[model samples]
Target: MDRLLSIEPLSAAAFAPFGEVIAAGAALQRFAINGGTTERLHALARARADDGDVVISLALAQARQFPFEISMLERHPKGSQAFIPLDQRPYIIVVASAPTHQPHAFLATQGEGINFRAGTWHHPLIALQDSSQFLIVDRDGPGNNCDEIALQPSWWLTGIDAG
Candidate 1:
């Protein structure tokens, strides 16, 4: 009684076992270039949380003037994956979750590249184009590995250009 899918375009053999969607190689930590000098891009897996209080959120996502939103989520009850980005003039989007079947529709592709992999069942702050430059890693402390599923029969990101 909960099934809807429309998110695709993830390789490495269709995101082999749901893990590893690379590329973000340079320009991280709020992303800066031309005058601000701040870099260190490319990171998909780096979690820590045995419970000690952790909640972090850094920023620098401007494209359409800040309207992207993703209410902090981290999960890995022995299974975690994520790698997010939709626009930032880089390109990367790979969110994983499919060991049997739950994917009915999800799509990504439109400027700034995309990236997703860690516990990927994405539908948060997905910019289609002209607005993206993010660096978010989950699981920090206080029994981390967050979880949230607030879907109300409305999900769509169906293939772009059918490429």
Candidate 2:
């Protein structure tokens, strides 16, 4: 049987347990640089790796259908993964804490991104637009950093329209 999971708006406070919310605004630290030609948001989220060198890559993600079934979740044991949207479209982020693994979904709006802490369980990218692109930052080279676990009672993610 499939259970329903509601998607909430992504926020720094709400997602703090699983990871850091990457966004720039008055709420975060900001400074002017390049002789006042640029404004910088400092340390939005730090990329972490236990062994391998941190690398940045591009991901072309296909749009996910609504009422999506989350059958399994994956985690990187040795590194943290971050996804920043390049297409300026909204997307969904599904995560769960250790032990209980009760899933929680978040809707990431335009210009917002997320960094999943190492060992945090998360579903793959769920892009809302067709042929969405993302800037992915994570570890490269090394020892089996990824792990996946199947959920016994799968979750049906809903509430994309509200997002």
Candidate 3:
């Protein structure tokens, strides 16, 4: 039998164990720049590259239907990966920790982004909208940075209505 995963609202405190939550709020450090026109949320999350230089890329992810079956998880052993939604649409994030590797799901609403810490296992992008665009920041160098593992008797991620 497949395990059922509960989806929870994404928050800084809840996600602190896996990685940093990228979002702008009153609690974050803020300042005005560009002649006081742009309010910058400084250093919300920092990217880590253990071997190579960090690079930015764009990804167009297809929408995933729910009760999504999570069969595998991947991690960057040498760097951290960050995803920023370009279309401001809601999406799903699934992560697991080391050893036990129990999966946790989070619903990322609009204006919220995330940066996975190095070696954090995570499922690929699960977009709720068709043809969603995302700006990705990660390492671009050599040495097979990605490590993936297949989950036995995969988990069924349900309880979210992607409407």
Candidate 4:
């Protein structure tokens, strides 16, 4: 039988199982800096890779229409991955619990992003409506950290920003 998952609004507690909800105004140690010109939030979350070195890069992801069909889930054993949107557009996050393959989904809000835990199972970035740019933070070096599983019947994001 085929599985269809309803998309859910991204939240800290709900998403804590797989990763974190990266929201700026959501209680992450804010402090005034540089004569109050900047507010610095401390230690939002930790990003890890097996190699212990992280690199910042930009990825341009094309838009995928609604009721997105999920074909596969991939994971990085070496380190964690974080996606920060530069276009301030909404996006989809599909993840599943490791070993058991219990799936979870999320929709990123404005000024919000996510950091996938190292070795966490997740789908690649899904942009909604239009093409989007993201700040990608993940492990870099020589290592077979990436792992993937292609779904048999495949799952789908049935609902848009619902549930």
Candidate 5:
């Protein structure tokens, strides 16, 4: 199993080669805020939930506040994408491979997030010191959108140590 690393905020350009580098804060087009007044607000790509044209809800839970465990890791083989909202203060982990370099590990801060490409290697439901509830938006279709990669039972990244 690979060791977990801290979530860092690198330029979106770094992830361009693999797929589109969309920042949550950039893709969103805010519609409403405060009172009746409205404006376009761009949110994190991985933070926005969209089911065609619907906006779903996501939440978060703190560490000690709620005791929980992640019993699995899943992947998407088809051209599926995911938007996992960090409702609480938690971190994110991304496992990707560079064309000519060794595989890389990425950890994102509570404010940071990721948009995984279909078939990318990733951990399932990672919560660092929090029962981070997420607005998980992925393909809920015919074939299996959730592909579990069974590794050593201990293959887990349990905390945020991004430095």
Candidate 6:
């Protein structure tokens, strides 16, 4: 048997229990940069990589076939992971609260990204529409940073509206 989930729109408040949504126009400190050429949203969230170095990298996530199904989830015990889309394409964001590990699904809208809090249980990078690229900020050092668990009965997410 498979557990089905309807993905909701990703929001900072809704996703607060698991992580922070990295999108513009949220309630955050803002300031002009480079003499007003660019605006900056400051101090969005704490991106920590304790005992490890913060490394910047890019990842190419391929789109999964329709009828998206999730059977497993992973977490980083040592650091927080941030994914910012390079092409402004929507993607699937699956996370679970601690203790119960109840799964929740969200679809990122255009020009949005997310930062998974350390130890946050989440599905791997899932890009929709087409293969997408993301700038990844994560930990890189000695430590068991990853833990994977098989979701009981699995989950199928559909009709994920991106808003």
Best by TM-score: 3
Q: What's the TM-score of each model vs. the native? A: 0.25, 0.94, 0.94, 0.91, 0.55, 0.92
Query: Residue pairs in steric clash, candidate 6?
Result: none
What lDDT score is found at residue 21 in candidate 4?
Answer: 69
Q: What would the per-residue lDDT of candidate 5 be over residues 1-163, giving only the tens digit for each residue?
A: 4533334553456654333334444454657676858664454443222232223546563443222223335556654355454453445454544222233334444454556666665555455555566665454445555566543433333443422
Candidate 6, overall lDDT?
0.84
How many backbone clashes does every candidate have?
Answer: 37, 0, 0, 5, 12, 0
Q: Residues 105-158, candidate 3, lDDT per residue (tens digit)?
A: 999987688999999999999998888899999998989999988888798887
Which candidate gets the maximum lDDT versus the true structure? 3
Q: Tell how far residue 48 is off in model 3, in angstroms.
A: 1.0
| Candidate 3 structure, TM-score to reference | 0.94
As a TM-score, model 5 comes out at 0.55
Report how far residue 124 has shifted in candidate 6, in Å. 0.3
lDDT of 6 by residue, 1-163 (tens): 8678877888888989887878885548999999899988987767899998999999988777767878889999999999999999899888987524568888887768889999999999888856689999899999699999887677888765333
Residue 96, candidate 2: how far off, in angstroms? Answer: 0.1
Q: What is the lDDT of residue 72 in candidate 6?
A: 87
lDDT of 2 by residue, 91-151 (tens): 9999999525679999998769999999999998889887888999999877999999888
75: Cα error in model 2, Å: 0.3
Residue-wise lDDT of candidate 1 within 14-129, one digit each (tens)?
65454444444322334556576755453534443343433344435533222222322233542343334533243324243632334322343432223333455544444344
Candidate 1 contains a number of clashing pairs equal to: 37
